[model samples]
Target: MAGVVKTGILGLDAMLNGGIPEKNQIVLAGGPGAGKTLLSFEFLYRNAKQGNNSVMFVVEEEAEKVLENAKGAFSGLKDIDDLVKNGSLSVEGLSAVSNASESMRQSSYEFGNFISDIEAIIADKKATRVVIDSTAVLEILVKDPLMFRKSMLALVVDLRRLGVTSILTAEMSSLEKQSLSFRPEFFLFDGIIMLYLSGEEEKRMQSMEIIKMRGSKHSFVTTPYDISPAGFKVFAAEEITQE
Candidate 1:
């Protein structure tokens, strides 16, 4: 069987037909407070629980803080503090880089360094699953779409080459008419998952739509999902539409 990586979200594997394809790059696009971080954390945290080495490459959230937040999200998460302290779960891009953009200029280095740091982590940890918390950081760092696309392509290529199945989270605009500037990422990655929060009449609902999954079969409908203390749980819309 081809090596496969599970996302750790309940019912997500079924939607993707069998988890994220081996050696592929997938994007988790959503707006702030849309459970992107929570979902990605569940993904990596579950892998660690399964004895599969994992790494979380966070550009937007601090490494230490991310883990701290994850504890509340996954009640069974073990030794995250020790794992981070012992270098099992490594943190990268602590400091911002130069001329990258307003968002990244504060970091000690540029996005390139962040990518390299992730590569090193995979080699060191033998990580099978990875999550780049927010690729949107690059959108702010590189103003030109062409340059942004090239840099993103390089990072995605490098991650896949390492045999790492990665989840890249991105922030989207709340408006249906106002789209994200980094829409180009859909082309740069292997799969695209879009999360949206909207109200139909009087009820507010959360929906997860799988836009594309190259080389694999995936559900075509917008599934309902919820973020809770246990992490993200995806359910068939028909079954949960009442909420």
Candidate 2:
């Protein structure tokens, strides 16, 4: 409890052996429709409810749309607006391609502006938790693979140095991790969780697996989870055998 950063997501926290280690950057990898955004927001929402300041940085989509979607989807979370208004939870969009200068936009390595904006927001909010919607948008902004990895590593380092536990979502194509290849940047983070859809179309289900956690022993079994109006409920005590 003293050093761990609790996600407050019921079974998720139990899987982490309490919660994520302080200042560890955890990547949430999943395919489309895997409830990645909702899960990430829940992490922030739950923690914020417990009084830890949290912030979410949107890479491509509008921030308000994310807020509204969360409100509509989680009918039980009636206080999301109140959290935002009270400054406990903040969702801000960051776009390097749109507002950056022509030179920075044209250069693959000039991503300092994005970092600066993020740092400013975190500092302003005194946030202890952070989430970056999806890292794919950052990749598109930097076409060079090598530079993208470099910039990502730099971003991870900055976040760690800032002393905040954060989540970075990655986009994947639908089943079996067959889509959305990730770069070596993942090695820069402390933990990895793969959330994907399984089963035939008619019988599909959402599941989560913990790939690695640096300082804690975590569950390796692919566990089943489903989204509900109350939020996400993870069946960590049971394992779902893959076909």
Candidate 3:
């Protein structure tokens, strides 16, 4: 039997019936300014603090810049720097060395090599938890939707084989419950977590929902959450009464 990997976020753990199933690939989908990046960092930060060595791989930005920004944004997590220095956590950025468009058109060798680099990093760090900042840019990298799906499927397989529970952030255009746009990722991951924003201006409120979790009995209730300097504070016990 497989044990659960605690996210270390109490409310989130409750929603997952304890924690994400061991080695599950979770898609954390939301729109711009939805706090996706911050939440991803916190996942690593919290888990690392709990002794689950973790690594964060970023594609859209530099690792140093991301870490610096996170430090400023989350003032309450004062020990983030110490965790990194102690080698319990890693935040690194990835660059596409080859022209993804041309390279992927020929074969999937580039993508395979890409996963290899990630595998190497995980091994070097002995990381049990992983986070890929976001995979939305893969469309531009792969170009062909068919190959894109293949690449995502391949990624899913590789991450599972690596024996690490991972989160792949996704960009979404809609936050509404019934109007979410269909995408390949909706089917590729072992679990789907939807982060939402509603209302407008200062009146805006954030919420989360567990759309699906393959093997676990997860809550379908959409719960409210707040992003303080303390990181993500999910209110798993309280459901969003309405939009």
Cα-based lDDT for every prediction? 0.73, 0.83, 0.83
lDDT of candidate model 2 versus the reference: 0.83
Q: What are the clash counts of all predictions, listed in order? A: 7, 0, 0
Q: What is the C-alpha lDDT profile of model 1 across 41-148, one tens digit per residue?
A: 778777776777777777776666776777866666556666666544554434422222343556545557657766766787788778887877667776788878
Give the per-residue lDDT of model 3 (tens digit) for 1-243.
Answer: 898888877588888888889999999999888888988888899999999899998877778899998999899889998999999989977543234334545556466676777788888889989999878766567768888889888888999999999999998888765677658657988899988888888989899888888888778888888988887788887443332
Relative to the true structure, candidate 3 reaches a TM of 0.90
Model 2, span 38-99: residue lDDT tens: 99999999999999999998876878888898888899888899999999998886443235
CA displacement after TM-score superposition, residue 238 of candidate 3 (Å)? 6.6
Runs in model 3 deviating more than 4 A are 95-109, 238-243
**Candidate 1 weakest ten by summed lDDT:** 94-103
Each candidate: RMSD to true structure? Answer: 4.5, 3.5, 3.5
Task: Kindly report which residue stretches of model 1 are placed more than 4 angstroms away from their true locations once superposed.
Answer: 76-110, 175-182, 200-202, 237-243
